[model samples]
Target: MKVALTGAEGFLGWHTRVLLRALGWPDPVLIGRADLADAAVLADRLRGVDRVLHLAGVNRGEPAEVAAGNVAVAEALARGLRRCAQPPKTLVYANTVQAGNGTAYGDSKAAAAAILAGAAAGCHLVDHRLPHLYGEHGRPFYNSVTATFCRVLADGGEPELRDDRELRLVHVTDAAAALLDAPPAGPWDAAMPALRIGVHALADRLAGFAATYRGGDLPPLTDRHDVRLFNTYRSHLFPAGYPIPLVRRADHRGELVEAVRSHGAGQAFCSATRPGVTRGEHFHLAKVERFVVLRGRAEIRLRRVGGRGLVRFPVDGAEPVVVDMPTMWAHDITNTGDGDLLTLFWTNDLFDPARPDTYPEPVAAA
Candidate 1:
């Protein structure tokens, strides 16, 4: 469907754009803050748009400015939509959970929602009262505590949390998905999937992740939320803190080193492959697997299930490197050297005979 989105440069808007593209939706016409200030520009942009996602607002500014800015943006959008030849079939407003509170931001959001509902005469309006949203690349010290914490920890600084307020955080991706998945609405209230935790607890969890990950160890990914949080935390450390060198202990008897460490890891196994032999040719839906070559040389190949290109990584036992397999990606390893290959494999979950997620698929399509 043709979509027009405001706040396209913001954190949540960026994720929504990515999700829409991943879902094969048409590229949205982005309406920036300046465009919202201009009725003609906004109206022109909304001309043939099928859906309108209104996500622009001022969260940080003078109290009066914040309140007026939000309401004005809503009013501008309403006016633009009314001027359109065909109003969008759906108008989704990104409201906050604080809309009912007595605070200035809350009052403004509530007012904006009301304005949109009134102006969206024939169109479906869905108001999502989202909670504290967090994800990769969120602006630090702006609104998200997760982003600030990640920034401080990644910069080798301590995050001082004076107020241990309870926060219900929803990943930006999940919020975007919820917006796309919501059905046509006539003034409905909804919330995205969130993880509720105290500020102190959240800080402690992130601190633990930083310590473990910096030490070249994989932190415990007990649940999907933890995994998402870990990924978000790591995204803050991009370009640096990568290619973590593993600690290797060597002796006259032989060298021994820990390949992977995870509090939630369930199973570990080792495999031996003869020269010119290949292993794996399959993919998993949820399992997290790591392949580490212990002896001989191998080439690990991976390709997304529906993708055409394959990614190949040559690994050797002389210098161990762990290659993690992503979900929905068909992967395999082949013995590339003249000698036999010895590989160690670790997975987050134990192999279940009854409900195996492994799907046979060639990494290289014929």
Candidate 2:
């Protein structure tokens, strides 16, 4: 289906794009700031699209600025829709649960939703009221408290609790799913389900992750929420926390090295690849995977899903090191030496065919 998106570069927008890529959908028509400011341009971009996910609005600024900015963007969108020769079949508005809660931001969001609804005469309008969202690559101090705490913990600092209120949190990917996977026939208004945690409790959980991860061990990821939180924490540690050198001990018989240290259950295995061959041209949504070169020279390349630029790492058995793959990154290992390459692989979960959680995308093309 042809889909168009506004605010396609924001944190949630980026995650939505990543989800679209994971679903094998064609790239959406990106309605950026310029297009949103021009009625004709926005209308032209929206033309012929099956769905238009309207996600543009201001949430942080002076009260008057915030209020005006939010309403203004929605007005522009409404004007654009009026100019469209054929309105989109579906219009998904990324509203918030806080909408109409008497705050400037909340009131503005409610007004914005009303504007879009008024403009969407014959469209299936899905007003998705998202909860507090947290996920990989969320901007610290701006997106959510989970992101701010994750950043603080990753930086070897303690999170200072300012408010201990409860948060009903939803991962941004799930929020994106709500927008993309809405029912075909709907003029419904709803909020996504959320995971609840108090501010202080959330800080403590992240603190535990920091303490466990600092020692090169995987924390206890006992559930899906835990896995998502761990992945969010790991996002702040990648490219710098990788290539952890294994402590090599030499005695009489042979050198003994502890490759992986885990605080939870997992699967460990190895692979042998011929020289000049490659393996693993895929990305995982929630799996924590590790690569260690036990007996050959190799290179591991990773590119962020739905993005450009490759992160490269060279490894050798002589000085084996741990390179853990970050979730949502397309990665691969290539035998660079003339000899056969032996590499150790470890994942926090046993392989399940029905829920593989793997998507194929070339690192070179990312």
Candidate 3:
């Protein structure tokens, strides 16, 4: 089913997007706030979408600005849904966990819910409410407790607790899956705390999850067998729901660099692996790249920022050719063939996020 998702690049939203795709839904009309002032324009843009998941808001903002910005976006989303020729079957509102008359963020969300409730006709309105959500994508606040504790512990400082700590915690992927899986809520489920947890326990739980994750190997090490990967130092957490790049097969295993590339930029090497192996969900910018399946087979998928209709290629050794991909197009190469698919890659420049390169975006739907 078609859907409209806001804050598509943010932690929760991206997880939700990934979940929806996993559930066999098409890519939703992923949107980031373009203009809050023009509610009508925004609404018109949202018109005729099947489902609109609103997750745009600031947890920490000047109370007035936060309230106004949030209320405005809700108003615009409602207008957009109303304008839809066929009202959406589901209009899921991603309300914060701290709802009701609690903090300013909570208060604003409660108010936004009111606006949305009024806009529904036959629309199923489900308000996904949860406490601090935790997971890989949640780097800062939502994952604040985990992030803080992890940073402190890694830096040789024990995590400090502010006595009497209590709060609900939801895994980001789990919460996102819940939102997508939540059928239109019955009237009673509106603005309800569907889930909850405590602060100290939350920290302990995350720490435990981190510790036992990937069989008690911790963050950087994927597995104990790869322990000899003495040079491997990848800290990013690949939450279960997302892609886990099969980087450097055992044969090429010893050479894994944290740096994107060593040579200038024009050179690159990617994998079209053994029939059962996969490559990655990550890509680089400023890298004029080319991919060639030297053996076996591959399914090369490419996508861009706001574009629809991914470019798909299911190639085999019988017909192997290099595909040149410009920076605007972020791509992933997979070995869908029965044998090892060796892919040759060449890049235009070295990796540099500051040079307007390397966007850590969602991998295409499998």
Candidate 4:
């Protein structure tokens, strides 16, 4: 079914788009700032869509601006809905759990919900009251403290917590799933805390992840929350912390190199590719994958799902290095040498054909 999405470039919006792509859902009609400002444009965009995910709003501005901005978008959308030739079947508003809490943002969110409800008279209105969301590529200092900490730590800087408080954090992907009505996403209450931790504890936990990962080793991802946190941390180090050189010890015997070392569960496999053969052209939603060249020269190329430029890395088996793939980025490795190319692949989870978590996308595409 066709879907229309506002705030399509925001952190949560991007994750929703990624989830939709992973699920093989139809492309969404992106409702940008221009569309939101013009009711006629928004109406045209949402006219025949099966679902409308309203995710745009201002949350980090002056109290008055924040409240007014949030309500304005809702009013624009309401106007658009009324103008639609065929209103969307469902309208999901990404409201926060703090709705109606008397704060400017909270009261504004509550007002937005009411406005949408009145406009979407016949449509199924889902006011998804989400909690604190943290995920990959979230804006530092703007999205959440998790993002800020991750960015500071990843950039070799320390993070200082001003006021420690409890946070009910949820992964953006999970939030995205709930917004999309995707399967395995059970009924999530407005304030369901997937993982609850104090500010200090969260900072320490993220610090531990960074320290372990800095040494080219995966930390103990004992559960889903840990994995999600680790992935979020790793997201900040992409295209910079790659090609992790392995410690090659040479003594009396042949040189030895540690290819895969993880404090978590994973699967490893090797592949031999003929010269000029490309091995992968896929992206993972949450899988942490690593590629190590063992016997030949190759070029590893990666491109973000919705990006245009390509990131190329030339690798050689003679000097082994680990290149971990970031989530949602399409990647591929090709044998550039004349002889057979040997490569080792490692993932954070065992292969499950039923749920491979892999999606096909060419890295060469712009």
Candidate 5:
């Protein structure tokens, strides 16, 4: 069957394309759009499409800007669907982790979801609300903790951890697999409603894989990532009602104790700016990491040679669980909170700058 994908060249979009192909689906019609809100342009490219995978939006930045981006995209898509003489079989929107919160990004995504939940029957719609996304096709800066930490530690610098924050994660490949295997139409099913994985354990497991990954001079991105990238300090480890866990420098220790203490002989650390801050814009050939949102909110973005995409996680400032970053992706952390976000930082093993294994990339021409 044929499918139409918006954000075809993006991280998640591109991965989804591969998964579709693996599932025996034909070449899906790729509907590439720079902005999601532009219905006229989107609709023009959407013709003759069987399904639409909406995976475009600003991961982090000003609240107004994020809300505008998300709301406009969904509204425009809905409007476009109405204009279709024969709507596509279904629509699967790649939603962010911050969908239920009051944050601009979260609220906006939630609003967009409402539209998808009630889309016209002829044009079926389903919201693929995903957690932290990491895989081989990710950017160096924001793919996952595995990717991020490997780079941070690869340079042999002690990572500055967030202390507290809880989050979730998932692998791009697994996410892609899930997407392609998803049932068509709206009203997500429990079997395939939406999947959430833990990035911490995922990272540790991959770290085990890395111990044996002695490939070329570059790094090795692997499959499998958790939704909660790290152990978020939940409740903003500080005195702020931002929902993030209140935290301190020592809280970092506690974060690791909970996330990776069981790994034995290995350690985990975190490195990402508070909400509103941008961190990654590169990639790795054989690295891995796990991101944990301890407090506030943030967006993790990834871009690679072939594609890119952004994902939002509304923390309201709290503790993180963990998310894994793989080598095949580039990464960066963007904090999205009004208060100082408390992020739990950890790593899989002792850093090795001498054997530094990672790569880099850029966001746009402009």
Candidate 6:
């Protein structure tokens, strides 16, 4: 579908564009804030556009300015659409869940939704009210408390929580999907799926992740939400605070280091392999596994089933690295060091002989 999207550079806008592209939608005409002020420019951009996703608004400014800016932007877009030779069939307004509240931001959103509803008389208008959103690289302090906490913790600073209010946070990717999948022509709030947690609880969870990840251990990802949150937290640590060195304890007896620790982990094992020996020639369908070399150099090889080439990663005990095996990839590890190899393995669930997901296949065809 030919689409025109406003605020295409913003957080939600970026995610929405990604989703649209993934779904095979054509490149959307990006409308900037400046374009909204010029009816001629906007109308030209809207020409032949099948859908318009209105995602721009002033989130931070004087109360009166914030209120007026939102209403004005919507009015401008409507005026542009009126001038279109063939106006868009659908107009999606990205409103907030606070639209019903009496605050300036809420009132502004409500007014904008009303303006779009009246202007696009025949076209489908979706006044989607999104809740709190958090994801990778959200502006710290301005966009979300989650982002602020992630920034502070990543920088080795403490995030002070002044209020312990409850928050329902939807990941940006999920929010974008909801917008793309939204039904047409109703002044209805999209039931945005969110992960509800108290402010303090959320802060604590992120802090725990920061600690574990900084200590060179993969934190337990209990579910999809945990995985998303973990990724978001790590995004803030880029270009710095990365390649986190593990805490190594050495003695005359030998050295020891913890690789992975999780309250939710169901199984843990260690293996010893002689030089030139190889282990693992299989892939799992549902199981999650991580391999950490502890006492030798090795090369881990992986290839998707039916794929031609292998992806090789060389790991060494001197500097431990964890490689998480992905599902559907046939993989194996070989000891490349002169001495015997010691490796640690972990999985989220205990192995069941009856339902083991392992299927043996050479990473490289012999």
Which candidate tops lDDT?
Answer: 4
Clashes per model (N, Cα, C within 3 A): 0, 0, 12, 0, 120, 0
Error of 2 at 256 (Å): 2.3
Query: Model 2, residue 130: displacement in angstroms?
Result: 0.8
lDDT of each: 0.79, 0.86, 0.55, 0.88, 0.52, 0.78
In model 4, pairs of residues that clash are none
All candidates in order of lDDT, best leading: 4, 2, 1, 6, 3, 5
Model 5 Cα lDDT, one tens digit per residue, 131-223: 766544245465455456544433433334544344454556456555555443211122432234344544344343334321201122222
Q: Per-residue lDDT for 180 in model 1?
A: 69
RMSD of each: 6.5, 3.2, 12.8, 2.1, 16.8, 8.6
lDDT of 3 by residue, 1-366 (tens): 678887777767766664554344677786656643465565566666777777777676688887777788888777766655667788788887567767677888999998998785888888877666544324633445655655443343446778755555445545665566643221111122333545676455445434443221223323211221111111233111112122232344443322122222244666646676666554442234456565687787767433456767676545544454433345677777667777766554445444433445455633
Local accuracy of candidate 2 as per-residue lDDT tens digits, 59-86: 8989999999999988888888888889
TM-score to true structure, per model: 0.73, 0.95, 0.55, 0.96, 0.52, 0.70
TM-score between model 5 and native: 0.52
Worst 10 residues of 1 by lDDT: 182-191
Model 4 alpha-carbon drift over 4 Å, by segment: 185-193
Off by over 4 Å in 2: 182-193
Our tally of clashes for model 5 stands at 120
Which has the greatest TM-score? 4
Q: What's the CA RMSD of model 1 in angstroms?
A: 6.5
- Return the number of clashes found in candidate 3: 12
| True-vs-predicted CA distance for residue 328, candidate 6, Å | 21
In terms of lDDT, model 6 sits at 0.78
Tell me the tens digit of each residue's lDDT in model 4 across 232-338: 99889988888789999899888988998898789999999999999889898778899999999999999988888999999999999999999889999999999
